[model samples]
Target: MAFEQSLRRPVAATIRMIVPAGGAKPAPPVGPALGQYRLNLMTFCKDFNARTQHIKPETPMSVLLTAYKDNTFDFIVKSPSVTWYLKKAAGIQAGSGKPGHETVATLSVKHIYEIAKIKQTDPNCQTMPLESICKSIISTARTMGIKVLKELD
Candidate 1:
């Protein structure tokens, strides 16, 4: 009701700031460790070259669901917020849009999260990633008023 609407508003605003959802960068940081990779640097490097560097370039950046052929989300949100939400769901910071280069491209939530970020962290990171981190973020996004674009089941 009114309470839910009030909550979603702020989340959407915060999302808009996290990532702008513009076109791919000329040299987007590829792989997990363009800056830092928790797992393997070589794997990231291999993944980077294969995923990025093939774009037509010079295209406007925006979250456009219609542009892709395999899009199947119930709600299509073309914004930086959606990107932010997905990264948050996966328990990592955003990477480059190009898969091998910086990121693995836009993917659905069910496809990304095996566990929360904290659980994936080193034992010394001081916090165990809780299973609910993803759910909590979803709840927050709901309050902020962005169409979740997924079924909670």
Candidate 2:
């Protein structure tokens, strides 16, 4: 079984994107990205929307699509990004232009822990310890000019 699995051809391409749940369309970015792989854009859009229908329509999701040589494809949907959570928690619309030198907003360590817990649910993050995830989130928050505080008021 292992040998047979190894003999199988590698996937032809992988496309990664942050798409809104239930909001895919045959548009420029989606169409061109999938078109290059010779995959049916509509099929992917419909399937993706259907699978994510339970989530809120405007929620942003990370999707990883793997296209096989035989034209079949598979995908995995992940939770929203850490930066998105940070922005929402800090009540900021966007990051500061001068991240290292300027501070845009502040969030609590409680917020960091909550976001880290959420991120741990992602397949790629399942093996990471909560502390590591929180540290990563803290670094990302700093890059976005958001301070992670011991407590928030």
Output the number of the TM-score-best candidate: 2
For model 1, residues 25-70, the per-residue Cα lDDT tens digits are 3233322212231223343333323433353333222321111122
Q: Give RMSD to native, each candidate.
A: 19.9, 2.1
What TM-score would every model get versus the actual structure?
A: 0.22, 0.88
Off by over 4 Å in 1: 1-83, 87-126, 149-153
Q: List the residue pairs that clash in candidate 2.
A: none
Relative to the true structure, how large is the alpha-carbon lDDT of every model?
A: 0.34, 0.90
